[model samples]
Target: MADEAQQGQLVNDRYRLVRALGSGGMGRVWKAHDVQLDTHVAVKELLLPSGFSAPDRADLLERALREARSAARLRAHPNVVTVHDVTLVGGVPWIVMELVSGSTLQERLRVEHRLPVEEVAEVASALLRALGAAHAEGIVHRDVKPANVMLTEDGRILLADFGIALNEADDGLTGTGVVIGSMPYLSPERARGEKGGAPSDLFSLGTTLYEAVEGVSPFKRETKVGSQYAVAHASVPPPRHAGRLEPLIKGLMERDPDARLTVAGALELLAPAKPAPPPPVSPPPAFSPPAPEPPEPEPRPASAPGIRAAAAAPSESRPSTTRPAPARAASAGARIRAGGRTRRVPAPPPRRPLRGLVLFAAGAVLIAGGSYAAYQWTRTQYFVGVNDGHVAVFRGINQELGGTPLWEVETDHPEIELRYLPVYQRKQVEATITADGPDDARARAAQLALQASACAKNAGENGEDSVLTEEERLLTDRCGN
Candidate 1:
């Protein structure tokens, strides 16, 4: 069959093979054109050994049909690949499915070594949704691995290849004492030849996500048998690069299937934590002046010749108490009478100069000068950093003064996403790339923009369509598709 399968060959006179997309031990997949639908599709060709017994051939054929049915059952699921039809040509079953332009997760890991923690979280969330949908239909995707997950060109994560999926509606087709799953991703129960359930699938997903962010399989050994043993009994090594995803991965990879994390639990762990709102600001209080103290009477001069002091007035007739003052008494110089002689006392010393007013004026001048100098210094300083997730140039230092930021965004490159930049460049942006002036800072930001564009382009070439905003789309367009 492998020799006979070639480009231009029509399957059941409907799907015309265009090219080989990929091949594995079980079968080969091809990019094909559907004449009836007038659309492009993927056709998977199941290949059996030429020397199979009659019963073995029939069993394999049944399994292929079961795979088609399982995928078709979840066709409405966005995260699961859609199965179109199944046809037989030359006694071989060919599965026709929707054509998705993308590469497998395994292929991506081969080039990137590992993905960022946030990106891995996104993948895990999508896969968890897909698994939840399948589990709802009483289906367990026995084979969940990096190679079976697809990252489409349209920023979609899809689970593919339901060849070994188990459906509760159908009688179990797997024979006893047979373990049918990748060794590294197989759950302990499955590795020990037990009939595993949804938990087993979860374990495989955990392994896949672990490898996605850590660049190494947790329990993978040197050989298949050794790896199987490790899966059955080995302790999962701690991940050094998983960041916040470490807990979720560890929970999913638990040795006890019953203790393993569920889809709901994993979703909870993946949910982004909402930031707390800033405390409310209160307005300042109004001001009021203090009350004035009453003036004290001046003491009488001792032994003054026949002079009567103002305090010597009779208590009962002390200016009629609260009555209006007499015109003569209101005068600045009031006379005192004693022994029929009239005398005058010097007027109170001129009010002291307002020392506080002079000090206040001096302080105002100093503050104004200091503010002008600070403003001038800020104009001369510039640095490159991130502003709301975009690369930007700032006019002052990244520090803060009295709870207020010292820097202001001078030029923001909205098209350049800070997260997409390479690790080294991201670190530089986070630490604030200093510059001699605004122009120099802008140049540095432009360099970071180019790096971001290059990174986005590489991701597209590798079939990883990262979600982007309108501004980010402009950057992607600059990368020429």
Candidate 2:
């Protein structure tokens, strides 16, 4: 069967193989042309080893057919890759599917090392939607991993390779006590040989997302058995680069299936906030004029003693004459008539001091203390940033004190040049990638070292003449590539 699969070979007298897209242990994927549909399609050819017994061969064929049926059921979903048709040639299943034009998440990770948190969330949300559709049909994608996730060139995330999916309508193919999934991403229940359902798929999705942001699988170990054990027993290492995605990843990766977040709960966490309802606009304040000052009392005219002697003698007998009080009292100086003369009232003296000096001294002390506290807080924060042209770790906030940066370089990786990084990652490093602590910052730098090495390898492969410096050669050696 392997020898029969060659370039330009016609399958079922319709689809023609153009090129081999990729291959795995069980099968190979080809970019083929569908004659009737007049379009390019990906064909999965199941290639069983000659050493396999009849039962193993039957199991492999059944799994391939199931993969086609599972994907065909969710053809309407935008996130799930559409399966076109399934046919058997020479007694082996050849599954035809839509040709997604882009790299896998695994390939992208190999180049970029890790993605930004927001981008990881976007990828996770798309995969969740796909899983939601699959779960609706009682199908579980048991083999979810970075390699099975397709990031199309046209801004779409598609989940592919449902070869190991569990369909409720179909009878179980694998024997009891046999686990069928990637070791690092296998759910604890599945690791314990349990028939996992929706929760198991969610756990794999969580592990994939975790790797996307952290550049390493949480449960992956040195060996397959060790990783399987870690998946079932080890606690998830805390994510330092996941920022806002930490809670969602943690919830989805919960060890207990019952305690893990449901599809609805995960979606709710990813949904954007409702813009806070625009803050409830308040009406403009009404206008009210201040009260006018009361008018001053009018001066009285003096009367001639001889012309109005009776009136003058009676008013003078009381020793003084007084005018009738006005309705509103004068707020300013008041005039008084005494001894037949008018005089203005004197103003009151200023009030005594209220310990203003003491209060001002206390305020100055508070301001100084606050400034010191802020400086101390900056010392605790750490970030991964670019120092000159290389990756470096800094201890302090990714901010500036006046015009000078508040951060200081804690460690410098001169071997990892910034120009070797992808443009997006270069921007992130320039802006700074926040870390939980000094150790986390160093770990982030180590990841960047790997990214730089990959970039250098790519450059060399593409004949770009990007000669690596002595330090860069040492970096590549350290990365074991």
lDDT, candidate 1, 84-183, per-residue tens: 8877777777888888766678855643456668779999999999999989878888879998898876778999877656664433224333355678
Best candidate, TM-score: 2
Candidate 2 weakest lDDT stretch, 10 residues: 472-481
lDDT of 2 by residue, 1-72 (tens): 553448899999999998777787557889899999899999988665455567766775776677667668
**lDDT agreement of model 2 with the native:** 0.79
lDDT of each: 0.77, 0.79
Q: What TM-score would every model get versus the actual structure? A: 0.60, 0.65
Off by over 4 Å in 2: 1-5, 35-39, 47-53, 169-173, 275-298, 302-481
Q: For candidate 1, give the lDDT of residue 387.
A: 86
Model 1 TM-score, all chains together: 0.60
- Backbone clashes under 3 angstroms, per model: 0, 0
